[model samples]
Target: MSAPTAQRSVLPPRPSYAAVLRVPHARRAFTAALTARLSYGTVSLALLLSVTRATGSYAVSGTVLSLFGAASVLLMPVRASLIDRHGPRRALPPMATLYGALLCLLAALTWRPGAPAALLATAAALAGAFTPPMGPTMRALWSELVHDRALLQRAYSLDGVAEELLYVSGPALIGVLAGLAPPACGLLLSALLIVAGACAFVTSPVMPGPRPAQAPHKRSVRPSGIPGLLAPVAVAGGVGLALSGLDLLVMAFTAQHAYDTALVPWILGALSAGSAVGGLLNGALPWRMPARTRLCCFAAALGLVIATTALAPDLWTLTAAMTLAGAFIAPALTTAYLLADELAPTDARTRAGAWVNAAVNAGSSTGALLTGLLIGAVPLGICFLLSGGVAVGTALVAGPRRRRYADRS
Candidate 1:
């Protein structure tokens, strides 16, 4: 009898790490990153201005933001599913167009004071539902473009830093525009930028095509569900809660003291600035350390910094504490993303990433509400301490489990 033919390896040839870094696709990915930053900034600024102007209530603004977040969390998976089925090029443009149009309509509807809460809620929901899946789609495209895993890691680090910049500049620009012109003006401008950014990214030549159809045997090579996906999701959710608590603490302190509402902006700016610094450092740091160890250390540091915020004698001290807390944000977040990527089944990468996002938003919403309730019942310092403690505890619990799972897998 003839010997069986030798089986061929199915894996694609791995590219050199340096080649991936220098590729045109990496450059194009960076452009898309910039566009995402600008679009987020515009939308955030408009939201803050619109809610505040219409309701004259910070509580209303917070509620609206929370609702938008919840909506985004619920809808992200749907958008990711579309990308997995249709490719980034087909999925992005329509989502962006719908989102932008909704924002414009929202601005028009909220132009007058005393706009109906239902109308505002409907507009916010629509905007959230249609928001482009830029982050996930872009990451998927980056994986396809940069052939080296190391280069992909660097790309993610840079993207994280860009996100920090968006938070810093986006709201500040909206505030300035609203003050100079009107709230509606900022919303209109945001819509224009969203359309522009989405169009630029969708038309980019480097975007990946839809996955090809294959026989059942060929398709069986997809990634299987990792044994411990739950741990990372838990960690992400905990971190989200911590962030929400911090936000509430800042808001409550500012409101009670009647200091420049501008302090809120400055505090957020400090946090974003610190996060950007962390992202830059992430690329330079030695990657030999275990991901879990680094994440635990970062989370512990964040908790300590947050707890110290209670000791601040003035806004300056509080800002300093916040900056320190922010320094850990990117490191821990990067760890989570790396873990998620490692744990994801090949066919479910986008969905896995979206799940992480959803966990975060859900945690944040929970934390915000929890902190809000405690503001009247407890000392502000105590609230911060409790929130920080929760974060530290969560990291201790989840970090080790994540490592064990990855090691086994």
Candidate 2:
């Protein structure tokens, strides 16, 4: 008898870039993006409206926001650790529910004409602590859905653009709502939206689960350990500090000149719009600069923009300068994420992402506090110039070390 024919194996045809994005899972990831944006948008509006109305002072608003930011920074690793252990679905729902409930409580408690500052601060801290790890989980899901690394990069770029749109439209929407109704109305609506968006995200078919072998560690309190995480963490923290300083400088300047505080939202909106535009351009451009170069360019450009704002002669010029300055925001943020991904171990990606987030929030808080203190003693423009100079100096010192770390990794 003739020898049995040897079995032959065939490889599946490779998918095209377009095909990957069109996959069902990838489509779900896109939907998740929209929901995530809506959720965060609502939270942002609530924070802005609640703090400003309760304290009747932008300084207090900044302080409350800074506190909320600190809460998020402190809790990010814990939330990420949960996701790393329990899978996104199991971990996210409880956190989201708690967060939504707390938001509602905060809104209800602060509805009075003059809520106590301590109470408001407590509410803000709770909201931050319980806010689900949507950003990182969504990103983790994106990694699972897309088969190609280039596609993953593109996906992240698109997500960054979406974030720009969220910040741009979200705060403006909040401001409009607050103008029309009471700030509490905005806060209430924010709670509802957060609940809706978060639930939708958790239920999405594309959300990934941790492998069965990687059981949720009941005792684990920190995110999975990863090498070289500190580098990205440091860079992110510095960038956050710079952005927070810039924010405070603008607010202080506006307040000192008695410019309509209404314009504050508009200035922030311009920055967001610029970031969105930058992300779009980055996506369309063929040149993919090394991550380090992108970081350096963005940091330098951001410093210049802040400095220019200090020199603007009128509101229009200031807004224009802010818009121009925003061009670097997305690039810098994107590079930070890329570095985090590079440094993170396979099992600790979510934790690594959280580290980056925490760094940014910490830096922002520090910068805001520093700038706020200086505003009382110096001219706003001088504070702006000083902040910008500090940002530039920090970036220059950190950029080289960051690049070296990236290379070693």
In order of appearance, the predictions have TM-scores of 0.81, 0.79
Best by TM-score: 1
- Clash pairs, candidate 2, are none
Residue-level lDDT tens digits of model 2 in 63-140: 677677678779888888778767877887788788878878777765765777788778788888987867777666
Off by over 4 Å in 1: 1-21, 51-65, 113-115, 212-227, 251-264, 311-317, 401-409
lDDT of 1 by residue, 1-409 (tens): 3333223345544434344457785666657656754766677658777888887877777667667767877888777767666777887789889988988987887677787777787788888888776766666666666545556666667666776677667877877787788787777887887788778887777876665433333232122244556666677777788887777788787877776776797797788788878766775565777766666777777877887788887787888888888888887776766666666544555655666667777887889889989998999989989888877887788767435354453
Worst 10 residues of 1 by lDDT: 215-224
RMSD (CA, Å), each prediction = 8.1, 7.1
